[model samples]
Target: MTKNAIEVNNLTKKFKDFTAVDNLYLTVKEGEIFGFLGPNGAGKSTTIRMLCTLAQPTSGSAKVAGYDLIKDSAKIRQNIGLVAEKMIMYDRLTAAENLRFFGKLYSIPKQRLEERINELFQLVDMQEWKNTQINKFSTGMKQRINVIRALLPEPKILFMDEPTLGLDPQTTFSIRDITRQINQDGVTVILTTHAMTEAEALSDRVAIIDHGKIAALDTPENLKNMISQGDANVFGTKISNLTSELVNKIKSMDVVTAVAQQDDYNLKISAQGENALNEIIDTIRDEGGNIASVTNSNESTLEDVFLAVTGKQMRDQATEKATPVHHRHGPAPKARVR
Candidate 1:
């Protein structure tokens, strides 16, 4: 059996009689890109905070990089780095200044730290912007520097909480590429994201959490296969001259379980089993419907598995209290984890 990079047993977090993470258990292998995916306020960030030792857990136990979550928190912090949902850099600082400041926090040698910082900036193609203050940079440029700052410690593990959240497509892909390169260099990565597309693209394995519980945990392919092995199918279809007659024809098909009109020219069809697509198109044509597009992709998708497990509820049951807990604050005088 492969040794685990991180291990959790019955981990739980409660805030004022409300459980944020309830009896959660997970084991992430070393050098694997592990994804934690869920909707907003699904305890993804809360879990990371606990593991990173930013927030103390209410109960249960975990080991990050062989250090105890509770007892060896300082050691764990020493071996790990974080790219939080919110940027960690001070906007008034230059890119190089921000990185040097964080690098010094880890007590790295001044000479070696400077070399590492330059290498990281070069790796992200941001060497030119190193002297510029963060407030002067675009969102993408700021995010790039923020990512490299996390790398200053040369940590064995990296926890990225929505690293590409709200980023443009180009910036998102750039971050994704950098994440892949980090994993290739033997760093284990734990990523949390709401975007299934990003999760599917980067994760070696994923755990989908809802209501502060593990709904499903497996490789993306396996999760998708779970949906494919089930009875229903999901397909995207487009038709020219779409009419009530054509829509009704598709709904009437024995193979089609249901049909929802996405637009005047498009329909989303849910059906069952092997030959549903062929039969759907056949019925559409028989009804004199002009076909513009018919996609019969049998490959399973991550969103399908998420829907099957989580349904449509995005609300968190445990932390639904006085104020919406988009974030959970730690004990007073919370120091920045550099």
Candidate 2:
């Protein structure tokens, strides 16, 4: 059996004059949580839509759960479950009813469907709300039901697009835990999010996309380390009355590349390496510059990666200021997982 759950080769999608997804190629291994990270208009959703067979690609090919995206769309649908940002359950129906309805649509046997509904309610910690009308449910409750509805068929591959967008911290944590549990049960997960912290915490590997193309792809730690290397080290002391003469003296020390005043009293000196750090400290003590704190301020984050590649925050382009990028869609946009 193939070890890959998803494979895309030179996948491209265009909308009139706009190239939504440029020639993109990616592979997701079976049972891995592959994170799709990108800014707004970076083509994350466009790629997901093409992979899910909701929209046809302008060029190239893809396969999901061993089903060809072009020729076996139905089979792909049968093996995949999609949970979008917005809850998509019928308001009038009870939570249990909503799950049963989608379960039937997937042709799950009646006995299995009932067992699945009970299991999902317990899984999401919403067993108490199972018989309650969805219209009366809170936003978090409704979202939980939406997730349950998507899992009705026990799909082999699950696609979650901004599953925790706009949710409270508690609710978001709960959702993250649920996702981990689902993956532990052997379901291959594809997650798309612009939230750097979320991607860092959940993803096994991340693909950073920008301007409809992938700029970098690797583990979060490797990406951080790549940017952290070759950074200048700086040391600081109390914010008070150090003069230009004192600054000039500090700069003359071995390995001290440069020295500049930070504020009213604080001074910033850049050094070549760890050796420079000790030289600066001894020089400061001899020169009578009282040290306050020392720290490495040049470290890079996922945000730095986004700015380096896309020149903007993923959430900055989202229409709703409060909504994460994975949930935002333009008018008349075709619906996919999220």
Candidate 3:
């Protein structure tokens, strides 16, 4: 049997009376990117803190890169690298200075560490800015350097807590590409993110975490197929000049099982059958509904799976957050309690 890079069994964490991570069980194979997905304060960061040994679990047992989580936390730290939700590099420090400081903590040989840092900087094509102070760098540049700092120790498993969080689309894609490149070089990575699209695109397998539990764990395709397993599913279409009358007419069609108005001019219609979309479109036009744009979606997405299992939109939890990103913890009960 192939040895898992990390194995978590019934792991749980509590801050005061609130349970942050609740009886979580998971296994991560070596050299594959595993995504831990959930809305903000869904225990994603707390779980990562436990796995990284930054915070100890209230109850549970596990091995990270073959060492015990509690008994050999130092050993685990030695074998694992962490890219925290908060940027790791010091703002006042130059990029090269920051790398050197982190490298020294791992006791990496100065000669070899220099080579590694240089290579990492070059990998992201930011070699020219090595001597520049981190504070002067753009958000994307700071995040990239933060990521490379985690790799300074040359660890076997890397835990990235939203490495691309707060980054623009271009920088987000850069982080994703670099993550894949790191996995290809034989480093197992565990990434935590709220973006379903990011998880679906990057993870080999995803664990949908919510309310301190695993809602679903499967390959992206299979997780999506869980909802798409039925013969027919939801297909969304946008209509111009949408009215209650037009919506009711679409809902009354034989092809449609359910219809919901997404916005003033958008409808999310559910149906079964290969011709479901076509039939709905024709019916709308027949009823004097103006067509603006029709997006005929047949495939189930990660968001669909999340909603089906949790009965809550991921964005619902996200939008409820009034605190800033860095201050936010797993859940409201966990983060703030008297």
On TM-score, the leading prediction is 1
Select the stronger candidate by TM-score from 1 and 2: 1
Candidate 3 wrong stretches, greater than 4 Å: 239-295, 313-338
- Point to the candidate with the largest lDDT: 1
Q: Which stretches of candidate 2 lie over 4 Å from their true place?
A: 232-295, 313-338
Off by over 4 Å in 1: 239-294, 314-338
Q: Lowest lDDT 10-mer window, candidate 2?
A: 319-328
What is the TM-score of each predicted model, taking all chains together?
0.80, 0.75, 0.79
Better of 2 and 3 by TM-score: 3
lDDT string for model 3 (263-297, tens) is 89877666778788788888888888888887766
Better of 1 and 3 by lDDT: 1
- Please estimate how well model 3 matches the true structure, expressed as its whole-model Cα lDDT: 0.81
Per-residue alpha-carbon lDDT of model 2 for 1-338, expressed as tens digits? 64999988888887766777788888999988988988777888878877776778878889899988877777788899999766788899898887877776777788998999999999999888889998998777788788778888899999999988888898888888999999999999999986778888888888988877888988888876654568446555563447666777876776755454557677655556767777777777777776667665655566555544554222545321111222122323332221
RMSD to truth, every model: 5.4, 8.8, 7.4
Q: Which is the better candidate, 1 or 3, if ranked by TM-score?
A: 1
Stretch of 10 with least lDDT, candidate 1: 323-332
Can you rank all candidates by lDDT, best first? 1, 3, 2
